[model samples]
Target: MKINDVILRTVTKIVVFIILTLSVYLFFSGHYSPGGGFIGGLVLASAIVLMYLTSDIETVHKGMPFDFKLVAALGVLIATGTGFASVIFGKDFMTQAAMKLNLPIFGETELASVVLFEAGVAMTVIGVVVTIILSISEDE
Candidate 1:
């Protein structure tokens, strides 16, 4: 498959950046909004796939800073660690806690431990999906 159209490549670059930004926003706003790590990760993975489709595999690899598999493993470790961390505090595994912090612009905000777990989920999802896409792309 070849994609040599300049317009398509330019559009893809703009769209990929937008999607990536939106994915991060979704991941961060997940706790209070409808979006979450799962959706965010999916969106991010899709953006990466779009990049792969618009350009060569070498470009995609260069764009990505690290290995997806390592990311997946680290995500798993983080999620598992977060769960066990609760146990260390005498709380049940996966128990969630929140704290209120006063900020300058945002005023008062509540930060939850679950956010870390969601981050792990997001990273794992991104890693798994990217790995699958790259593997398939390479086999062809």
Candidate 2:
């Protein structure tokens, strides 16, 4: 199926950017608010899928610049590494530490190791979803 509608292509470009931005926002806010890695990753994947639908497979692949399977593996490795990092410090597995630090622009902000864990989760989710979409698209 070829998508030749210029309006759709233009709107897709704008919407894709918005969706990607929102996904990142959700990921960051998740540490303190309601959003989280899972939801954020799903949103990001949806944006990619939208692009895939609007463009050719080759174009989508070129834009991605990374293999989905490799991404999934990296995500797992990162999450595992984060979990084991605590062990190296004589702490239990997956132990999360939080600290409040004052920055130049951002006043006092709380930082936690769990953010890394969430990032891993988000990457894993995005990789899995994209892989699934690629597989299905290829099968058709």
Candidate 3:
């Protein structure tokens, strides 16, 4: 690749790494704190958008490891499904509730399932947004 390519790639990689890493932290923190999934996912998508700016979609495809559409779809499905999950049990939509945890790292963690649902929404929002933006910008 050209020297410009190398530099841009490096910058994009750094940015993506930082944003994604931060996103994970923020996303997890949101479970117990104020931040939510929408912001975290948007931040994550920002990282991907940074990479998209520096490289072609073809290269991004190779590095991303999975289909963004699929991942995003899963997030949305999970979030929307959360609504159905409530009604299935005869609960109201977007109702807040506690859930059990079994993780050894954070044993007996108290998590609000609604928060998890919101986080999934965040992921899907960012994913769909980035997809649209990248596709549109590709023409230029």
TM-score to true structure, per model: 0.92, 0.93, 0.77
Give the poorly placed runs of model 3, Cα more than 4 Å off: 1-3, 65-73, 99-104
| Candidate 2 local lDDT, 7-29, one digit each (tens) | 88999999999999999999999
Residue 27 CA error for candidate 1 (Å)? 1.0
Off by over 4 Å in 1: 1-3
- Report the alpha-carbon TM-score of model 1 versus the true structure: 0.92
Look at candidate 1 and give me any clashing residue pairs: none
Error of 1 at 21 (Å): 1.9
- Ranking the candidates on TM-score from highest down gives 2, 1, 3
lDDT of 3 by residue, 61-128 (tens): 89776667777898888898887788877888866688788889977877677776976788697879
- The Cα error of candidate 3 at residue 52, in Å, is 1.2
lDDT of model 2 at position 137:
76
Better of 2 and 3 by lDDT: 2
Question: Worst ten-residue run, lDDT, model 1?
Answer: 131-140
Misplaced by over 4 Å in model 2 are 1-3
